[model samples]
Target: MRPLPGLAAASVLLWGCGPAAPRMAATPVPEASATAGVSSALRPTAGASAEPEPIPAGRASPPERYDDGVDVLHYDIELALPRGSGWMQGHAALDLRLDRAVTAVDLDFSGLHIDEVTVDSGPVEWHHEDGLLSIPLGSPAEAGARHRIAVAYRGVPDDGLILGETVHGDPSAFVDNWPNRTRFWLPSVDHPSDKATARFTVHAPAEWDVIANGRAAGPPVPTPPEVPGPSVGERRTWIYETAVDHPTYTLVVGGADMVIDTVGLAACGEAPVSPRADGCVAVTTWLFPDSRAEGASSFRRAADMVDVFTDMIGPFPYEKLANVQSATRFGGMENSSAIFYSQQAIAAGRDIESTVSHEIAHQWFGDSVTEADWSELWLSEGFATYFGAVYFERVDGMESFRERLAGAARAYLTSADTLRPVIDRRGDLFDMLNRNSYQKGGWVLHMLRREVGDDAFFAAIRAYYARYRDATATTDDLRAVFEEVADRDLARFFGQWLRAPGYPVLSVSTRDLRTGLRVEIEQVQGDYAPRFHIPVDVEVTWDGRSVRATVPLEGAGGVWIVPGAPADARVTLDPDGWLLHRLHGSPPSP
Candidate 1:
């Protein structure tokens, strides 16, 4: 994580001082019936007609291929902790993946306290707590495609997720933050980069309700007497199955006493459908009863966003998508099928449309289509950030679009912690994914829009989604699509922004003239490289009217002359703020 020149230097200065972090905004569900094209196509400048093509259901395209990967455990957790009574008990079925065999199977155990352990219905050796568990079998867990494992553990989960310790103490530490700590409470890959499908049969006190990923199969039924755990008291169960082509890390489950809303998502040709061979998919959401005062809401917009994304990228890859509102540590988190948003969002009287839309957007980028590593997080986060802005542009206008881009630029530039490269391999995962991944990531997209001339850029993005939907992708894969669509080599462009650190700073000077203006701009490359390309905007005012001209810095600095410098001068570097670079200039002339 070598620092980049510009903000990277600033980042170093505040290395241990808790670098400022950006708010990970809430992801909202999109309304139904909108077109499935990138919002860029909907721009007025594109002369886009209101009429859009419709996507058919059931003709599902295959998601990008992946290895069968592996599954270590299948948990059927039944716990009752809400009433401060009852016990936590569940049967675990574990399957181990072995490239070669000869040893034990290890399972994560930071939260659950193992009470009983058995393999093949026989007692086995095991350990508990502190995130390490080794279970031995009668024979070495052989190098086979799969091996079976089972364990039963019960304990109370801390009220919140466990984040790095703060001065207050461990219990007060932030939970459910980025890079995810909740997974430690349960067993899973624990990182977004290693997603796997899991099923849950969770039991909670009947007085308190439940909400989780996947579709709920049925109401709470009495646990069968044959089951080893106690079936005492009124208990509820939730069933969440992973969607096809969904990223493993996006899988999520949370429950509380709340009012649940169910919507039958019908397959209108205009709305997106699940990859499953069903004409229509049923969608449901649960919101806290306290927050329902806003207004009557429907899933039409969410369906439309899904439709648009499916047509542009591929069909929605999962079995189900749920946008649930709850008290979460962050603005929103893209849990595989279920998205958990802050309860304050719906309570604070905020426009929740964009929030739902953004989180759903992650279903495609961060959830379904995941970045290969944390370093390329911008590929996941940047896509979502731009998607929100594009959604805003469609609902509003170009002014809104400009405002969003400008805000991103300002936020990225002023933030002292933004010097990190947009693509980073190692560091604090949370810090790396903050402003640099979001705001600067938006700027990278803005630059893409400018470079690809809108049509090619949007077309390329749609094509990229279609190519990589519901699968893993890397930065190189993304650039390939752009190169194909724009019909040019973008290696240099990506290199300077994604790989290299820091942006260029410009020094501009000009001489007054009766006939024209003489301008000289000198560029300095901070610590990275001296060679870079930038667009410089200069405006000259005569009387009350002003004329503007733009010059591109192909090398370090250059000179240009403009006709008739009469009254005032204003100079800007990358006036549109297309790149994540900075500018320095002489005082304006009058």
Candidate 2:
């Protein structure tokens, strides 16, 4: 998403994208910083924050994409959770091929009271050090090897990350926002770069319901005493699982009272010709009981948006999709399989229904095909930002569309820290690149659509989804898709917007010659020192009709002569407002 341009008295325009600096979280914490309070100086500095611990030297590796020779497969996870949030025990069966020998098995589990670790039901020597639960077997895990392991542990949960105190006061915190919360919640590699399928069966209180990514195969079952576990009446125990591989960041789990609803693909009409092919995938949303009042109204219209996005992009990847309104701090978070929304959604009423649309769109960007790293968050956030606008435009009108863009642009321009870039290599999940990634990114896309034409841009987006399904991508990959569709090089355009830190300020001056017309345009650097290559549209009323011409930014300020200058001419910086940059204009001189 792109930052909004400043709405100053001036009409000149400027634009840039990315976090100004990078920041890191020392511990697991929800990245729920108030967007209104974030400042540019707060962004993380490149190379300042440490990178994720590197993968052990010679371990079995996962493929980045579908390489011809790389191992590509699916997995299924089954888990059991004991009540009182004390401990979770489960037996995971891996049906995967190992390209090379796996010396050890590493899974992440923080604050767990681990009692035993075994392989294939046999007691095995293991270590619970360095936040990793690993089994050290003398023999190597042979290539194409398959194995099953059962792990049992007990501990008081870390109580999860404390984002902030909610109105209801349920801790209102979520894990993995800034730091990986899964280490406290589940065992696995806790990073976006690591993608896997997890199926969990949690045991909790009988009165409380257990909600997770995929639909509950069935109701939670009572645990027999044969298996050591927590006491009942104190908490409930249950089981949950899924076979879908998800970006670690998208993995989310929460427990609460729910208002469940199901919908089949047939219920929704046929997909539009212009939408994505996989858009027909059926989805479901699990709202909190408090959200039931407006659940039907909000989600009932979901099929329409799903159809539109599916046709425009690709089909939904999961078996069922859901939006769960929990006691979260943010407006909502796009978790894989399920989107966790804040209970505030209940009070927002009909006008706020679009929140659902925005989260749903994330299933494709942040969930399915994730950013390889947080730096390219613009791909996920910017795409979703624009998708939300598209949905609003489809449901509302052009006026509403313009209003939405204008609001976003206004927010972007007025942001306290406007110098940050959208793609921050060193920024954390909730870094200060919001304006750059969300607002500026959106504007960059809008500009691309204008430059390449809507037909090609959307087509390229569809192609991109088809090419990188269930994988990660960078800015170059995105540019490749557009280049393939437009049959033109977009390096210069994307480079200017994605790499550059600021924009250009255009000043327009004009004079009327008795025989023709003279127009002068001056260009100055906005936020950065580099001169910007911008497309300017000029309107002139000649004869009985209006004529428009496209001009380029020249120097600090330059003049243009309209050989057959119209009788009356008016200068417009960017008639389309495609660039989320500031603009300035000089007063007319007598």
Candidate 3:
């Protein structure tokens, strides 16, 4: 889904929406650094089977609009796509948990030309209106009661499931329901807050490959006469089911004529069919055979990247990870286990690590550890951006990682329209994808790492990921985890960085004493911006030797005394680019 400005998945040559935006040229990655303190993330005892701890509830109340009477638990959908007519037929069955007594259920729906509705295997009264469908249950279900609602519909979803032609001119169909477009095809509570397990039985021409969110539920099973299945053509129904619950936005379907690359990740597990298996993950890549060489070149490092991230985080979190090369509204869409990439990103001999890594990172951040509300978009975008930078730091040098953050900081500072906090409350969906959510968000995490040493930072990351995995989290939820790990309140730290609008601007003046140097750093921000509490790394040079150490600076201004050998000693502030603020006095610093 689009953050603020609408972001494509990832890439240097590829910004957010692939082919939608062009950015800087691509940079090659170096080999990963030797494992140091972060290896604890991959503790052998902490496998994928390690149960996720219950995440603490957010301090804020759940948004009223999202607290619908019915909570969707599972979805079983059957859809049939015919050749030219843009029209389609479908039947959706939803297992729901009732939160309150209700004679009617409301679901977000745009256009489906519904035919009928059924509840408890019987006919029910229903009405379709502007952006919603009201289904009368006839009898109100009591709180805590479980019920099933089914809807049969036939119409065209020309705006939802994106259909186009690939380079080989093959008909390609991919899901692009970022923000809120799922309603165009499925009749259900289409909010991210309403998560559910899903099973899809898609009917298309036998020649086209059908893929969905979960693992393949065996070969094409014959349509059953026990229910209303796709009868649009002589089609075989391919069924897929998810073992883990997921937001509707991450639900995906990719159908096309393409080649496949299968690589087994024998560490994560198999599809829930054999719930007792070794939990191995299957990695499959889909691309047109004509472009197979280039696609192969672009995905050569897929396995390596998986190993790197798994080592840095916990075990891989899905039954399988499918990398599909397709025509998308975005360069990449992290649709749970299946990640769709733009056909345009495929270049001979060059792997699109930026996009791939970002999407894979989402398997941990966005997909599993989802944001509670759209306002906490940084938890998804920022986490992906920074983790991508961290991946670059591992594979590329520290300079490359610094360049990425500096570029993000520059983009954030230079943007004239950026004034909102990183935890933006704007109702507009596209407003969540701006530089503040992406680049500067990365800087926030980067600086946080500097604040808490690397060991604690990575541990906190794994802790947060594992704790919130398969659940929704807020910015407050994340800050709580970090604070607990860092053993500090961090109220001021997160407040000034996330709630405040801009970064700090400092002006420094140094005084040379007979024995050492006294340095005064001033916050030059006129108003509106906050004076950050940051640890400024200072360097003191005197008579051919230099000493470096971090000096804690708090509030509007502060002074630090440097123990030195002479008064003529030169003093420097922030010798390394550890903080995301501007310096403007005495010796220049980055």
lDDT per prediction?
0.55, 0.56, 0.70
The all-Cα superposition gives candidate 2 an RMSD in Å to the true structure of: 12.5
Reference-based lDDT, residue 527, model 1: 64
Q: How close is candidate 3 to the true structure, as a TM-score?
A: 0.83
Q: Which digits, one per residue and each the tens of the lDDT, describe model 1 over residues 1-590?
A: 11111223443343224322223222232222322221110001211122112122111112221122334433333333333322334345654565565456555444545555766667777855345466765565555656666665544443233222221111111124246443344543344444455555654445445555555554444433233333336544444454344443454455555555544463334224344355454455655444443312533376556655555555565556666665465567766557666544444434456556667777778776788766788887888788767765766777887787777767766765445678875544556656778877767877888877888988988777778765678889989999999999999888877776666677777887767778787776566544566566666555666666677778678777877664255544455545556556431121
Error of 2 at 577 (Å): 2.2
Instruction: For candidate 3, write residues 1-590 as lDDT tens digits.
Output: 22212323443233222232122122211222322211110011111121112211111223676677889999988776654335566778899988998878888766556666888778787877666688887777798888788887766564557656665566666777776667777887877678889988776655667778878765664333323323334444567898888888788887776667764353453223223366556666776555556666556556666666777877776767888876566667788888888766552223566777778788778888888787777888888888877777898789988888777777787774246688877655665668888877888888888888899999999899889877889888888999999898877888888887887777777887867778777888647777678888878788789887776778767777877646677777776777877666432222
Candidate 2 regions with alpha-carbon error over 4 angstroms: 1-102, 119-150, 159-179, 219-229, 232-243, 262-283, 294-297, 347-351, 526-529, 541-545, 554-560, 563-568, 585-590
lDDT (Cα, tens digit) per residue for candidate 2, span 262-343: 5435213332221224534445555544445544567766666666677677766565566666655556677766776665
Best by TM-score: 3
**Candidate 1 clash figure, as a count:** 35
Q: Which candidate is the best by lDDT?
A: 3
Off by over 4 Å in 3: 1-62, 221-234, 263-278, 347-351, 541-544, 563-572, 585-590
Model 3: weakest 10-residue lDDT segment is: 38-47
Locate the minimum summed-lDDT window of 10 residues in model 2.
38-47
